[model samples]
Target: MMSINFEQLKERSLVIRKRYHELERIHHESEWTVEEDALAFLTDAGLVGRHVMSQQGRWPKENTEEELKHKIGESIWWLTILAERMDINIGEATESFLTKTEKLFEK
Candidate 1:
């Protein structure tokens, strides 16, 4: 069985958040509102990123680094919210994931 490090998971999450902040620094003009804004933001990012992927062209819309950073942080926010909503901890989630993965590996 492979070992999962809880600290490493948290660190990766923080790294992603840090990158998001870096992006925000580069794209600071953007003003964002949350929740309803998340869907629109993802749609725009996906669309632009997809266009860039498909046609090798730039997106017409401008998304700031801060907005990008917020998106990444938002994921962590959602995850934390889920943990709180379900009354679970990061450790519990880690254990559950480990158990499920191990069960699959045993098959």
Candidate 2:
């Protein structure tokens, strides 16, 4: 895989999302609503939590490390899509969050 910066990743994600939307329209005669996208994100986020529980031996079924890793990445992809749909800049939001959290822990 090629190395990509955040901007490039966001662009690629948008392209992929557009293609998915097109496919959805062709198959179902409508693309997913923003609320549907958000629900999808939530579903994936829940899977991430389940994987973490598996890692900690708290889940009934064991999950592989690779499964957990991929789920985490997928959750991030969902977040980027959600931010784009909501007209938010995910990069800026993440930066602001990190900066604010760091300031709170400063000596």
Candidate 3:
């Protein structure tokens, strides 16, 4: 198992984003729009849900567990990319959400 902090993940996401842009330039002559990126994220997120359903036996499929794991990771990658594209600091944002939610649940 490998351990990576959010900063490392962000750096890797940026590297992948650059490669994706290169491919887009080669094939489409332009980078994808933010909306397009969001749509792609949504597509992966939907797959995560479908895989979960399959895992629960609501939808029948072989290898649901592996596919679910992949989709979950892909969704997180897309979210990190989206946050970067929108100029949001994902780590800070995640911390803020966690802190706020935890406070709300405090006894």
> Which candidate ranks first by lDDT, i.e. highest?
3
* Model 1 lDDT tens row, 1-107: 57546556555655664566577667884433344335554565564444444343344444344555555555555454334435567768868999999999898
C-alpha RMSD in Å of predicted model 2 compared with the true structure: 1.8
TM-score of 2: 0.89
Superior candidate under TM-score, 1 versus 3: 3
RMSD of each: 9.6, 1.8, 0.9
- Candidate 2 deviant stretches above 4 angstroms: 1-4
* Candidate 1 segments exceeding 4 Å error: 1-59, 63-65, 102-107
Residues 1-107, model 2: lDDT tens digits: 67666687689889999999999999999999999998998998898899899899998776457898998888888889999989899889999999999999996
Give the lDDT ranking, best first. Answer: 3, 2, 1
Deviation (Å) of 13 in candidate 3 = 0.7
